[model samples]
Target: MLDAVADLLLEAGYDGLTIDAVAARSGVHRTTVYRRWRDTGGLLADALDAAREVPWEPPDTGSLAGDLTEINRQIVAALTEEPSITAALIAASFRSPAAAAALRSFWEDRYAIAAIVVERVAPGVPARPVLLASCAPVFYELVLLRGPAPGDELAERYARLAAASVSRSGAAP
Candidate 1:
């Protein structure tokens, strides 16, 4: 049921996703869905959780550059791959308090995962802000400012620059 709702939410945006629609798509009773998840927010939250990426394991390649490059690459791929989901969630967040809360939760988890990798690479520097700032130029300029990078080259460049900055900060080196 959650998967069915998630599919609908991803494809149709939050406004278009209805309990009845999910029930019809999933072949489950509307009453059952309502009973299991009483509200749209709750249903959407569950679906988002189900759709989240599993944690990526950090690698100790003895080089922060390589590890961070891989991490950022993965992040770029994941973000770019889900245009509909991102659009729907962003749109939902603006109008729905529940979706805003869910987005907060989602971002927290996403940052936390990245923080772990940053902590491993640079033990002293703070992870969350630094990492976010490092990638902000790319995501902001691409996603918010310009509209996505030209290709993997731009993402790779961002990763390398981020890794270099962290490495040069005189933390672990």
Candidate 2:
């Protein structure tokens, strides 16, 4: 059912997604979907929750720049992919508080897991800002600014710059 929601979201977008569509897509009965999810927002939130349950871990790339570059590359790929699920979910988040909260929770968990890379940069540094410094550019350029998504090399450049900033700040050697 969650898969159906995701597929429907990708195929038709957030505004076009509907309970009937999801039910038909999944071959699940309408009443069952309604009983479980209640509405489109519920379905979206559950879909996000289901995604969160999937196994994921930040890369252990042997260096802060390497790890951050890998992370940034992933962001670029997700945003640039055809029928981008990440972009779709981000759009969906704006329309539904339930989906928003669920999306927020997903990021919170992702950050907590990814923060270990920052920890390697500085044992006790505030992880979020440092981590954000490395990856935020890709999102800002690709999503917010609607710029052409550059390949992973540009992502690596952002990571190098971020790592240099951290190093210059005496956070790491």
Candidate 3:
């Protein structure tokens, strides 16, 4: 069902998505979907929550640079490969309160996972900044510049820069 929702979201913007469309695509009855999801926002939130179940173990390459590089690589792949879905989700978050909440929860969960790696590499340092620094440029390029996401070379560079900044601040052991 979540896959169906994702497909529909990519094909049609959030405004085009409807509970009926999701039900039809998912082959589930409208009543069942309604009973479970209640409305489009609830359905989108639940669908995103379900999609988050994909495995995303933090990297353990024995160095902050390597771990951050891996994280950035994943981010680049997600943004470049699924730009439509990514943009749709982001736009929906701005348009709908439920989507905004769901998007926040999704990012919080992702950051929590990234924090495990950051804490391992730099004890006592806040991970959010490091994680954001490592991937924000790629998102900016994709969204604002309307260009391709930064490639692997840029990912590695961003990772090294982030790791260096944190380490130089004496945050690492």
User: lDDT tens digits, residues 68-133, model 2?
Assistant: 999998889989999899899999989988899998898888888999998976786788887788
lDDT of 1: 0.70
Q: Could you tell me which 10 consecutive residues in candidate 3 have the lowest summed lDDT?
A: 141-150
Model 1 clash number: 1
By lDDT, the better pick of 2 and 3 is: 2
* The best candidate in terms of lDDT: 2
**Best-fitting candidate, scored by TM-score:** 2
Candidate 1: residue 47 lDDT (0-100): 68
TM-score, predicted candidate 1 vs. hidden true structure: 0.79
Task: Tell me how far the alpha carbon of residue 62 in candidate 3 is from the true structure, in angstroms, after superposition.
Answer: 2.2
Q: For residues 1-173, what per-residue lDDT tens digits would candidate 3 score against the true structure?
A: 88878888888888777889988999999899889888778877887787688777888999988988988887777766854676788777777788889888988899888898889867789999988888777667666677755579878988889889898999783
lDDT of 2: 0.87
Those runs of model 1 whose alpha carbons end farther than 4 Å from true positions after fitting are 52-55, 59-61, 82-84, 146-148
